[model samples]
Target: MKTPFALAAMTALLLPAALPARSAADPVFTAAAMRAHVEFLADDLLQGRDTGSEGHEIAARYVASQFDGLGLKPAGDAGGWLQRIAFQQTERTNIPAVLTLTGPAGDKSWTHGTDVIVGLNPDEPKVDLSAPLVFVGYGIENARMGLNDYAGLDVKGKIVVTLRGYPKGLPSEEGAHLSATKAKVAEAHGAVGMLSVATLQSMKARPWARMLTFANEPDFTWVDTDGQAHVDAPGIRAAASVNEPVVAALFAGAPQSIAAIRKQADKPGGKPRGFALKGSARIQVESVGKRVASPNVVGILPGSDPVLQREYVVLSAHLDHIGISEAKPDDKPDTDRINNGALDNAAGIATLLEVARAMALSPEKPRRSIIFLASTGEEKGLLGADYFARHPAVPVRQIVGNVDLDMPLLLYPFTDVIAFGANHSTLGPIVANAVAPMTIKLSPDPMPQEGIFVRSDHYMFVKQGVPAVFLATGFANGGEKAWGDFLGGAYHHPGDDMNQKIDWNAGARFAEANYRITRALADSDAAPLWYQADFFGDTFAPNAKKAAH
Candidate 1:
């Protein structure tokens, strides 16, 4: 929270009647409004709103029109409401992927889709190998942590099958999770292809739901490490690993138990052993890739005062989801397709839209320009937000603050709104003062380890020296299990629908709270400052004006 320099200035200058009386304890979040907006955005008519698709274009136009109706001006090039982003939508083509293994008994072949699942690998999909299969344990190569799965192994261009996650007894005190990191290390070691043996439930063939909406774009190209282009390779089929007793094998001495192998792999003498199988192994796969375009929508409600108007405040929310999912046994009866990202972001968008409307209705305009951004491709690695941060529509340095609205399924009784990056700026006091009347708790960041502060669209602003705030309903709901259940299950999957039960009144109340805060900041006279020790302070330090040139 930035210091209340603007609030103080406003109080000093305004006559009592001239200023809008701060409403007393108005609930800003409303379940009804949230549901209405979500129902519109996530309805079957939207078709999951995949990026760069016709449905996505419809969504963008609708949102832009809404902003225009709220009296917000175009913040994009040529005074357009949409911030057009050039994106490469890719689709996979028919690519041959084959795996063959020669063992004592004979040779075996595995077809794609049936044998393995693959991450996006570049073109030149042919991966032919006859190398020995070595169990690289957990596939991690972190020497600084005293764990190196690739130790004492020559895995160059060979098949390196390993377990996911880090080695046992490895401390997680650091932010490092070895799963994704280890995969990169394996790739660096010249492993032609990597495989993670499923230990939890053996593989079950996951039902193919519709591909994520973003996957539909034809401009989407699949790339490998070598940057070669390839079409869709077969997807890895989910299957269960079984012991020889569950299968008739050609009489082998291979390790039959996953537990035994895991235990052995942890031992000091358990260097990954390369082995020749008594029988051959075979793999086959089939898949497709397409390319498309999506954008991060931006509009500015410029401030009234000339000097102060140079500074900006930002409000943002992601407008994308995991696209639609295919039906599974766990799917609900009414809705069998489309992962309607209701609470995931449709609700957040509603909050954003409502705030913009309320601001426009207020008699007094904000001192600093207010930027309302609706970003696309958040589910696809935060690409839209990332691009905006790199190429901002406004001068990035002129932006003083950001507020990102993420999740709000239910409001608690006397619940506190947790603000991530609470210590990063002086805006804390201002936020507190605005919400204090309503008795809303203005708590410090709740889960820094979850990295929520750095996960959303506001994160892109924060990275660019802008003090940003991300607010969400309490995960615990004043320590209730029901809220936790809603978070764990419906967060990103298909079940996050509109009729999932929500406190609409609470939502409206919270929305009102946000409205007051945004207005207060906008009507203020001074720029919000980064906290003294905050990371962004150095970039906008008081003395850096001379050096900025």
Candidate 2:
């Protein structure tokens, strides 16, 4: 609610009035420095820095070296930089997935490639499904929208095939059936299996967005399911309704056409419905599973005040990228094979390094400990962070705030930084107040649709009731359109390489700005907190909402 100037004035009141200004000659962050780090991390030699790979291992060492050079103390478990994790990487292959339909005539078996393709469910061994396939409309259940696609049928142990995306154009609050939340709905309905059809557009463009899930890797989680989760088989592929002819043939005499089914799913009063298709399926998969290890590099700077030093302020950045993709049908060059991830997170990690260096050299350490956390497996699902929060090096209760940096370079030079999940917590004010002096305007989270808040490693901390923030540059800020162009084209693609053109000076200034804000929090007496309105604010105090006035 306060102006940036008012916040700066308050900050000035907290610190010495005569604090000396940083010298112009002081080394600032530069793109050259960031590019230098990216060169190796995103280099062809790193082989896309795949988790548990030798290349990612090299990257870990490099980041650790930077932390070491900054004189940061090892703050990991057992006082080691690496907190080792275990995982299994599985690759399935050569399994028979057959389907057959028995009608008034005889039984006709469906071929694997033509009728359907099978994938394993996280549950291992084998998952054999022979139940009738039900078209559960869009599989949406919304009270407000009056849409319930699963109202009648008992789908337990059955495979529910549905479409992707929400209704074409409807007020979101009206409960237009959303395809995004179907996985949870499927699980809740006791449905053992789910098959999501590509959107009509995606079906027309590409058959399906073929997914390559990681097997449990030593460094990251391969299977993206709850450990307690059960799958009838090791894996399952919910088949896609890609080809129109395929849909037509499958639903030959069904109650509703595929389009009509999707339409009904979008309307109010859409209830659990069923249709019969004359087809049977057989599924099989053989996979290669391996074990590997990855690390979340951490370095700590203890605070000046003994009592407050026990409390911690964490600064984090993910250090991994989307390693390599399975070779696609349209082959390009060797260079196109790797995803450099220069802007996605290499820039973020580089900025964190600079922030740590600056903070370590500050005139005085703040009241709380400052932790430099280089998180791994962010590309996967923030696995390193999840492990860290569960098995903390320090007490989770002692962590006051977590400031996470994702992609900060591409959108710099804007009027302000986009502070995501601001409405969710009290830390928003602290972040806003801290960065005021840098003329860095902090505003509410911009791209909530992207679920940016939930997507980052910071969410792991937030879930634990630790106040957290994820900072990114914004296109809405006063930078060139190229900034947005860069963010869009190279976010997670192979073309995100470090070349000649980049604004290194702006990056340096941005790093400096982040350093100052971190210092402010580190030195402050009051701990950062989540506002009562935040979804995770109640984590620390289960009754926080009820207690709110």
Number of the predicted model whose lDDT against the real structure is largest:
2
- Displacement of residue 117 (Cα, Å) in model 2 is 6.4
RMSD of each: 9.8, 8.1
- What tens-digit string does per-residue lDDT give for candidate 1 at 1-549? 665998978877777878767564333445576657777887767766766666677778878988888888888656798776655443345674454555654565443334433334323223333445555666766555556777677766555666544443443212233453555676677665555564332222112122223232333332332433323222222111222222223124565445566565555434343332244334333334344556667888888888888888888888776666666687668865777777777778888888887777667677788989888877765667767776777778787788888766553543667677656676666677778877777876554334465566676676577766777665444624645677667766667776676666766766777787787777776566676534344543443221111
| Candidate 1 vs. true structure, TM-score | 0.65
How far out, in Å, is residue 254 in model 2? 5.0
Model 2 residue 474 lDDT score? 59
TM-score list, all predictions: 0.65, 0.77
lDDT of 2 by residue, 136-227 (tens): 76777765456677887677666676665445443331222144457667667766556555445345434432331222122225332243
Backbone clashes in model 2: 37
Model 1, CA-based lDDT: 0.61
* Model 2 segments more than 4 A misplaced: 1-35, 95-118, 134-153, 162-185, 198-257, 264-283, 324-336, 444-446, 477-480, 538-541, 544-549
Q: Scored by Cα lDDT, where does model 2 land? A: 0.65
